[model samples]
Target: MTVQEQYPARYYARYDHAATQPAPVTGWYDVWGMSDASSVPDAADLVALSAAQWSARTPTGLGVQNGQIVSYAPPAPTLAAQARSALVQAQAATWAKFGSLGKTVTDDWITYQQALSAIADGSNATATDLPSAPSS
Candidate 1:
């Protein structure tokens, strides 16, 4: 099976507090059985945390310092970044629904798809005035 490379926005890792020497990795857990991972410092048995034994765990990017959870100051995404991301999402949804419509695809949708692809490409990647998506 292929490995998942991209991590969620609020990813977390868990390691033994007192064992394994040091394995405190931040983002995606990179340390594994000496083959798929590089050794981490300050933690051991590094594993990605999802949920607790009871309810589903929330993705909060929780951190530990000394022993208490702490907040991290990740940079906020820019407006252009948000716009470009929306463009990508629009492209994916439109293509999935309309791409296989074949002859049934309308001219408007075709134009919309092209515009989305274009913005997602070229140097000008961000746009505030994106074309409206075709009705569901």
Candidate 2:
């Protein structure tokens, strides 16, 4: 069994306030295992955040199109799909950065499946229930 399955978010949160070891304080626990109601950032939240950060930047080198499309042309069917994929890419990086961090990458990949399920639903767009944002 994987570490995350053995030590789910609740395990970390329960011991976060008292655990004296590094196991409960670093890595995923710090981000995906927060004390908040949701363990991770929703897809919508990440998308909006990424968009905001992207918007704040000034693109250089590329000549301005003026009246043409000047944004990153997404290859996904919906905004949710694009956002979800972006989240996956970030998660993969996180998995690679922290000694695999209790198999954090595997766990996030599983969670990504769930995010896709949520996004596929015909509900109103919101970031309230998306999975955690992966690393940069």
Q: Highest TM-score: give the candidate number.
A: 1
The deviation in Å at residue 4 for candidate 1 is 32
Model 1: runs farther than 4 Å from truth?
Answer: 1-38, 42-59, 63-70, 73-102, 123-126
The count of residue-pair clashes in candidate 1 stands at 6
Can you write out model 1's per-residue Cα lDDT over 1-136, one digit (the tens) per residue? 2123322212246534663323232444433223443333333333444435113332554444444334534456654555468667766676677675653556777776677556656545555466677776
Model 1: per-residue Cα lDDT at residue 86: 66
- Global Cα lDDT for candidate 2: 0.40
Residue 42's lDDT in candidate 2:
30
Clash statistics: count for each candidate:
6, 2
